[model samples]
Target: MREQTGLGKVARRQGAATLNPIMLARDGDSRLALYAAARDHLRARGYEQVSMRMFRAPHAPEQNGPSYCCQNDGRIAARRWPALRAALPAHIYLWLNAYDRRGPGYYSAEDLAWLDAIDPWFALNRRPVPSRGKACLAGELSLSVDGDGELARCHFIPERLGNLYTDDLADMLQERSCPRFKCDCYIGYAQRKDLPFQRVFGTGVLARIAPEQ
Candidate 1:
């Protein structure tokens, strides 16, 4: 499963008018375009075990709706295109699973291929993303929030900072750290190392803030 920073939650909390029906519609169109791009990329690589399903939101009710169970076979992009299309938002949360029966390394290869397909889309639309001095293991460059409204380090490792109602986010980000050696997961590292600040964050914010360790 892949999710961005809790921007959706923040948007809802802030009551950002940007999530209106008109914005959602535009975002839906972008999702469909990316879906077509991903499907084509997989087919070209001769991968057939991959499947994609879109949910309205993370942990959304199963019965509520899904875009469709799109596979390599000719089942089209989505089921009930009109209804499902409208449900997608600018930030999509994807639950990717590979059932490649061919051999090992199947899942990862397919995942990388999918990332290859969507990376360009993210790059082209990328904007100036604010980041703390250090990067978290999660794909996005932002903090997660705990149930108590406190800032969290990461979903996998949930150490809470003081509540947002009282504490400073900048201070919280400064205080957080991983227990083990630094997390070097693929997506995390890609954002921190492989891509340039221009490609990822629109400007040199990361490079400027983070001098060589």
Candidate 2:
């Protein structure tokens, strides 16, 4: 999707935040402004489908919390989740399937490899995201852009691709390989305000470094 040019040599020389080359993804409840800006910026560069946008599972219990995407659509929108799935043209699934989320475990590289191969958004028009009722397929496609000028695969979430974490948007875009989805790292760290830092440390890594007891 890079036939044109938006951030040219001038931009690169200027040291602009250049594209992260990552596909930022988020449910309706997350911050999509970054994603939108990324999409617009990438599009300007003559790139089509450089990134993608998607909502979460319509039937997922909202008790967990509402995502930015959810707020965009009304509760009624979710209520019609089934109709939404039916209306969709056979190929447009977002998130992983129930089987994927099944089992007590952490995400593995195999998981990301499997995901990168997904192509759920072939046709771009939909009132609501299709429901899980439909058969699952590999949703490998441009999802959305990152705040940086990079083209992304999705709008709300960053791809771990084998690495447990990926904040580098540039590498994500430049590299098209899917097998490199195994590692463990996430950029910058911060958790919900409600959750205590101790919870994250859990007296493991921190205890070793903190002042002696």
Candidate 3:
């Protein structure tokens, strides 16, 4: 498929052909069809391990635009979640993180309520809420690097910490408290001291996980 071809070319160029690639699908009526195609394409490439992420809105409105807003259409997504899970291939693992309404986008009380309702569903599936004693390991354990080598706590936070090319990598790796008040993204929160992600994924938390039977 065209998508697979594009991914293959990019992976080859980046020397990441051996790494497991995750296909992200946005929530919508047609997402099932998209996921099925992606599944078939990846499996055809002899990828026994595959990961899929569902994109929800209000997280990156500046880039995703108004159409990606799930605040208003969350019920539709909630209805589709079960079927999407059921349709997954036995060898593919999937994860859904609740949207925390970041960015300049607006989320009303009703939208927040929708999030409150759906977050538990995500928890029940695998992703869990951090307990009170859990410390978020955002800046300490995870960071994002832009193409220019500038670093940030994560993609959600744009404040640059340092440049990987110019600065000492060791100094930049210091553990620090998260600047944000809340983080719901998996890449950010999965590093929480309380999450079982480490036990479940071991050293491959960033890329691979055992597929559920």
Candidate 4:
């Protein structure tokens, strides 16, 4: 599909491309944490601008939609990939991700196809990362709020559970826990056993778990 924006011509470049990372999340707080780190990382790498797209899920209003976090303009927040294609830099690297652990069908085949069609640089399906070992997420990797809307302790051994929220941003930032000496999702099975957790699952795998939006 042709982009609606003014960039008229698609400038295809030949050579190594600059990395333009995109992180997606369905949980608001998790999204925030990922985005916060990504923004810092991108800026440090010399990117001056970025874009974010967040919305209510197509079926579940209480939950968030498959969000888009990229180094584009904020105006592209609610728009689809075609619009984004027109706005992104000509020689930039891009990867599209959809957050799982929000339940099933968070991102569907149609959604992924749309992304792939618009940007050949789209990244989604990949060989599953092999399990490394039994690493916990509790305080070692993730931060979650409790049901009472309070920030829980930093480390919970991955067995303990809590309600996590973006509102506890300050505490989330200050708190840090290392349940293991090394944590690597791609290298090992560094995961949490509770309701909400994070890991390196393929986009197609995550989309299959939930209904498409």
Best by TM-score: 3
Q: Name every residue pair that clashes in candidate 1.
A: none
Error of 3 at 153 (Å): 2.8
Q: How does model 3 fare in lDDT?
A: 0.52
- Stretches off by above 4 angstroms in model 4 are 1-80, 118-127, 131-213
lDDT of 3 by residue, 54-155 (tens): 342333335433333333332335557556656867545555544444344444566555454533335433333533334655567677875447676665
- Per-candidate TM equals 0.31, 0.18, 0.44, 0.25
The residue ranges of model 3 lying beyond 4 angstroms of the native Cα positions read 1-84, 87-92, 97-121, 124-134, 157-159, 211-213
Name the best candidate (by lDDT).
Answer: 3
Candidates 1 and 2: which is better by lDDT? 1
- Candidate 2 C-alpha lDDT tens digits along 76-163: 3333444555675543433212222224544356644444344231111111232222211111322243333444332222332222
Model 4, residue 10: what's the lDDT?
Answer: 13
Give a tens-digit lDDT track for model 4, residues 1-213: 112111111110111132112221222225345657877676676554423333223343442443445422222443565676678665432344334333365457886677666644233222232323433444444444443344433322233233354353444443333445443322222233321223223233223222233
lDDT per residue (tens digit) for residues 53-162 in model 1: 43233333454443445333222442344345247452332222222232554335554554434333332222223334544433234555643475655543434455
- Better structure of 3 and 4 per TM-score: 3
Candidates by lDDT, descending order: 3, 1, 4, 2
Runs of candidate 1 exceeding 4 Å displacement: 1-141, 175-198, 201-213
Scanning candidate 4 in windows of ten residues, the lowest lDDT window is 5-14
Which stretch of 10 consecutive residues in model 1 shows the poorest summed lDDT?
93-102
Tell me model 1's lDDT, rounded to 2 decimals. 0.41
